[model samples]
Target: MAEVHTVYVPRDTTACSLGAEAIAQQLGRHLAMHSPDCRLVRNGSRGAFWLEPLLEVETEQGRLAYGPVTPEQLPDLLAAGLLAGTTEHPLYLGPVDDIPWLRRQQRLTFARAGVTDPLSIEDYRTHGGFVGLKKALSMTPQALVDEVKASGLRGRGGAAFPAGIKWQTVLDAPADNPGNPQSGRKFIVCNADEGDSGTFADRLVMEADPYMLIEGMIIAGLAVGADYGFIYLRSEYPLAHQVLQEAITRAEQAGWLGADMQGSGRDFQLEVRLGAGAYICGEETSLLDSLEGKRGMVRAKPPLPALKGAFGQPTVVNNVLTLAAVPWIIDQGGQAYANHGQGRSLGTMPFQLAGNIERGGLVELAFGPTLRELVEDFGGGTRSGRPMQAIQVGGPLGAYLPAAQWDTSLDYEAFAEAGAVLGHGGVVVFDDTVDMAQQARFAMEFCMVESCGKCTPCRIGSVRGVEVIDRIIADDNRAAQLDLLAELCDTMEFGSLCAMGGMTPNPVRSAVEHFPDAFGVTPESSAGAA
Candidate 1:
């Protein structure tokens, strides 16, 4: 007869790292002993990572939030009558979305994340979960692809290729025949191997609202005429993998995925294939190779994946964010989704603000915000309150940007024009204490460690690159070493098999170009100084 109030806590990896699991246990013990009428629900993070272990209590007013909680604070919170949803603690953050940090931006793909119980199918539908998939069920396959095309949604997994274009290719390709199993069968794969530094969007999606991804993949399968799909998740994210496995089992039982999807009589079989720890596996072709029990190496592209992929079948490979975005595009017409962001870069970007920053976390906004706004305003500047020196847009392969270039727009084309690429929307800030020369050297070192060694340029050149940078750092003929470094980067950029070696030069070159002072001389004075 008594009302059972619900409490929400995040099981997100970032939140867990901040002792959310321990905090959750303490809350459970405290609420049971003190407030027996309350229930705790472990949800995903709300993306404001700085305020992790955020607790949201259901109230007539709304879900009131209190945050960055630890196990030690649970007793005090209970003593303060926190379960009544009227706690006046200093750490309380009124309402979750009303928090200026979350309210300012757009969140399309991540609509249900941190809000719904990850594995609860009923919870998912209650919060606008299956609307996209239900919409997709009515339209013809070509019509669905066209709707996606009209949305102008590019790949969120670094390449920025149009998702509809890839789907159209697979749709046009032949379907699986009895005699030719590989040629006729089409495949849909979600590239969940989020190995990029400072990037946790993929992990967040999988861990928090996995059914959204399942729905997206099923929609993609229906559009591309594919019955089989797999989410190639990396091994590092144990929590994501476990959550995805449980979520898939739930969907299979609930008829969201399997031989008969939602009684539509259509088939979309989904599986989760774990990836080895090789960063190179994040590449689409390399991912396919790894999925097939082969050594994870880049495949030649004459016969494209659209025509021949995944055991020599026509396949559609999309990033988790790219596919997860589909449900929203379908539910809210493509034009509506298109109306949000700036220019050709349409829709919201879940920008991961990370590394040595003050208020770092995931901030999803439309594509117009400049780097300065992201680093300073949303991020609250550097944690150390030091002069912000440089920032890396995108992942490890992305270029390092100096303070002079902070005004650059976060648009993909704008970044490309400036010798940069928004590779998966990771922005890592570094203060004045950083040594550009050393950072540049680490770029090459990272490439060497992650390279599949499929090409001579990546394998051999990376070694030579480290040697040349050591020479530059030692001031042993710095002028010649600089020239050698430039030449080596050019070789790797043009000669490498994949982006692994090709884009490694992005950070190295940008560091050398922007902060010449770190290298001990300007280009104009290099020879004289040497």
Candidate 2:
């Protein structure tokens, strides 16, 4: 085994894009020529995409960090004695965890994020991994659910529904179902679609600590009396998909998964299923539809996926983060996890700070943090380094929050009060360069293009929406067009079946209300209103 004190670089897509690999190759030559005692490891990313070509040295003080450190600058960094802790590289920051962006996060699901060689089971076990499964095996299935109930964990899959309650529902299903608890026929599925444009937390977790997701699924299966699991991940993330499959294989062969998991007398099996790039399939029912080999269309609510899911049997459908966080909660006890966040939104949230934002990466935080602190302080404003004009919280279905509402806390209920959703905890920043009218129209256009075409309001309403925005933008019948646009938004708000139709107007309506001048409408056109 190599010494803990080693030089490491991230090899995730973002780092690779910035040539971290080439830097590693160069550093390997330098290390062989100079310090034979030094070891270097190419590891997965820390999810800090912007800090690519990042270098870390295990220092006596802690794991000291430096970033965007290219091979071109290696001579200086080496001469400065990075290994001896005498380096003052501008990128050198003491302890990766001490960084405000990474430190503030509660990090149950992200416990192993930047610290370990992601694919190594030994690294995982050394960090207190698999404790949840060992603890779960000692309890009855019903008792396991009760422990989760005490943990105050809500689904992180855009819906804040309680995870324990969902598990209870599956356990309550009749025992007469086709398969016995040990038969491996019943299953749990992780929804890794994560189609939200600005969000990448789930993908990062899978790429970094895929076994956490697998372990979480095994715990879900144990608690809910299921014997098998499937993770329906998106195809766009080939790296995540590949990493997850390899993790599953490793878990199975090591007896961490599959029948007789960890010698607990429990039978559980897991696998990965890839999605063909349909955003609509992120919806739980729609995900099940796609999993069943059918078109991905949103199904009406009433019988939630927890009750009747995946092949019409009782199933637990959870987001990757939601499931990934379970092992930590269970291992450390419920109260330790529950005490981290604000009321109603308990536990840490892996907020994906991206898009026009300056700090574009995963920032896990306690729930009470304000959106302003998240976007400005952690994100450091827009990528272009301009003052933020408008911000969209949640995904595209969310509202366009003006600068005035930036003080709102990042919680489900708090965001709901501002007429926004913390859907998937994605905050997309926009500078003054963004056109509000264009952004509004793009929301409806997204809905129109992605709509399953099952209903009228979303299908027909979206096409008309494009024309109305064009008219408003072109200054044709200005006031009348604005009023007409408002009317159409109202109809979409109340008339649509699912969020696709119902919430598509949120961005448009908020944009219109907050930035009226951006619409390019004038009072003179109001003369026709009479």
Candidate 3:
């Protein structure tokens, strides 16, 4: 009799896009002929995307990795004793856990990612899944809220609002279900609409360790006295949609998500609602409108979502990463989670490195490392091997940071003090070849295209912004145009209804301030520069 071995090939979108499916098929045929007893497992990516289709083989020593493999290389890999987990193969990456890229930082929320079969309930449980939810069931709702608050967890979805405060608001807001005073009809909404450029953490969680998200959502539902939840997923993420829907069905069948969750008598029902590719729907209020089958548009605050949301009921609106962090807080205790980060930005941030980076992927670190460390140490500098000129933290609306600002700490307050944002933890790199003037123009153009047209500042102001930038670049009354651009940015920043219009000026102003030559003006001559 032969011992059964396991081979893991990532089925996540990144891996599949990089020919993981072809590699898997090639491996399957070879396995059947050579080692019939061995099993093939379709797992999630380890977030080291440069190494995808990263193949892992479980052995007595540890899980060994071989990566960036092509279908043509499969025969050579097998011939080099790949099935026996041989390090003799050039592609072998030693123990997966020992990789410097993965070993350096903390992985609380993503602890189980790329480790287990994403849809397997038994595998999920074996890897400490649902431990947080089980613990949450033993505690009172107030205690749960307090635990999250103590952890100092803030919204990971750009705004950085305290998650515990939002939870408390929904908890304190009386549940008004119309005819039934005791109906308790509050809702939990997970904003999975990851429309920001260079952001994929939300999609990764949904595709990799989906149960973590499901468990987190369940915990949120229990804490807020809500029996129903909806994950407002973006239409662009078809793979995430399929994985989440399947995970939900499996969780319900296993009693982790149904009316009687794990026999605890909790009645939380969850579903996924798709958004119509509108970037504005990433906003909580606009997401609610879309969830209710209306056009995606922003709603005025004061009647906050925590007070009246999702069909005129009190609601908890949090993004994927924010909710995904809950189970860890509950399972490990709030203070334990709080002990990881710096200042008010407690807990680890899964920073996504993209654009011109050499080793572009996810790097989850505590909130203290400078941008230089992330780009040079982890990212390995620019893919073009050229000098790095600027880095755009957060999304398109985030400020374009120059090399002078690279040493700034990654803390929320630190970034805020530097006139930038740590939005969604996306760090997009740019080489010296990048055109700052064109980049600034695209920021306004993007806003003009994506704005919901709900407010004058976002709709009309963005259009005017593009024209002003064009005139500035054309050198038509350069200083005067720059001054006018500054005034227009001031209007949009103060008068806009949301960050869409407000933050559009971030890149524009930063570019003009840092790289005046790109805008046809010298630093000494540029007027109204930040």
Q: Which candidate is the best by lDDT?
A: 3
TM-score of each: 0.97, 0.93, 0.98
Backbone steric clashes in candidate 2, count: 0
In candidate 1, stretches whose alpha carbon ends up further than 4 angstroms from where it belongs are 1-4, 176-183, 522-524, 527-530
Candidate 3 error regions (>4 Å):
1-4, 177-183, 528-530
Report how far residue 195 has shifted in candidate 2, in Å: 0.8
The TM-score of predicted model 3 comes to 0.98
RMSD values, in order shown: 1.9, 3.0, 1.7
Ranking by lDDT: 3, 1, 2
Model 1 agreement with the true structure over 11-100: per-residue lDDT tens digits: 989989998999888888877887777889998887888888788888777788888888788778766667776557887889776888
Predictions in order: lDDT: 0.88, 0.82, 0.91
Name every residue pair that clashes in candidate 2: none
